[model samples]
Target: MNGKLLEGKVALVTGSGRGVGRGIALDLAAAGARVVVNDIGASTTGEGADLGPAQQVVEEIRAAGGHAVADTHSVADWDEAHAMVQTAIDAFGRIDIVINNAGILRDTIFHKMTREEFEAVINVNLNGPFYVSRAAAPHFKAQNGGNYVHITSSSGLIGNFGQANYAAAKLGVAALSKSIAMDMQRFNVRSNAVAPWAWTRMVNTIPAETEEQKKRVEGLMKLIPERIAPFVTALSSDAAAGVTGQIFGVRNNEIYLFSQSRPIRTAHTSDGWTPESVIERVFPMFENDFYPLHRSGDVFTWDPV
Candidate 1:
């Protein structure tokens, strides 16, 4: 509730021209971070560019006495994405945080999904984070401290029908964050992800035209906006530095920290095994100790057996 939680910090947020990205950019600014707002000004389908959204967010931050600047960079390109981080350094002289929130949806069933559709989703949702985070990693290392939060989605964590392209790309983002966290632990650069279930323009792609689909949409309408921001803000804070390589479903006024566990193993297998024996004994462990597809927090635990 106190402003200035991020006082003196400089944050770069990608895809911050509108929707959830815009919300995060403004919130970070209000918390006293000088923000670089990056957006390609692209549409939901990742088409076209208009500088209005990024500029508007900057003005809003300025009007509210928060420091911010606009950046019109496509996240898919390494050069432009690097420039985005450079803008933060140029203005504030250092980078302390990054929110990889830029994304686009190119939904299609696997059968009907074209290579173009798949690549577009992967390039924006997955590769975009890759480019920005790659550029920011060094700066974070030099400073010896920083936070990185990637905006993932429920569709990726829990599979969605007709979202093969989007889901794969989002899951890739999660995987990328995990690797970054593992490598950056010694440098104090924490990395994590947030799986948001908010109502945004991205959700418009969900097929809610049918009555059944509409009911599902109405059910989700109960989730509030305030509930989503806290978890994301926490992930981008000093308090969450100890927590990395995780994912959280932030909605419904509560934060659920996701965890993954390897399936139990009864024995080491030989090279040649019988299918029946494997199915009866080995597969049972998978039923009980399966890792969560989406996870968060410290999974390494020591408990008395």
Candidate 2:
């Protein structure tokens, strides 16, 4: 890849103080885009705030001779999200890309989950992207071209235990990306979601109940966030104009294009049947089409390539 693929673009990345977001911000900068590194410096559970994280990333970019500015804004807030986008414009003169990577986790079984836990996860993991994307919508429309990259997860794409809140928010984010892609297609705006499997602080929280589980987690730790950033940077570039409203996954040396929901089977009757008749006939015909319940780990059992 050319080192200057994004040469004149200005990109904004939320929650870029560290981890996956930081990797993305740095990669975009290295690709020649001016970057707005926005991060509230919140913990894994979204409590407290510091400016150090964002500033540190910004300094790293500068040390590498890449343009970057730090913006300590909470993406969960509507006003702050807008300010984050505006910060890009004020600093670099335009916003050409927005990566909504801010998120928090509050995992627990549904029976034991609190309303506070659920809402907190929703506010940051899901609503944060909505607010940031909404703020960037008008600018993208005016510019007639832009890109949005939302960070999602396999937990939401499939399912996971003790993560009702996180899964719901991540899935909601994927849906939101699809809606935005459709809404802005006419103006050349493209939006997509990435389900990244990297061993970040969030992933470290998952319990390894057995020796096998512990070994699996250890293996995943080698799939660093940097491995995911190149794909994200490509998606943000003009070269990926043909791709939109899609879900993708990145592991160690693997990339996956996920299948979207579609009708697997259909049933009909010459005349509309009663509920009893429908249950007797239609249910039997489509019984085999029903999907078995499976969690995220169950589906992705192989080691990351």
Which one wins on lDDT? 2
lDDT of 1 by residue, 130-157 (tens): 9999999899898789899988876777
Root-mean-square deviation of every model = 5.7, 1.3
Per-residue lDDT, model 2, residue 265, is: 89
For 1-305, candidate 2 gives per-residue lDDT tens digits of 64789999999999889889999999999999999999988889999999999999999999999999999989888999999999999999999999999888888999999999999999999999999999999999998999999999998999988999999999999999999999999999999999998988888887788997798688778778888899999999989999999999999789999999999888888888999988899889888887778888789888777
Model 2: per-residue Cα lDDT at residue 19: 87
Task: Give all TM-scores, in the order shown.
Answer: 0.88, 0.96
Best by TM-score: 2
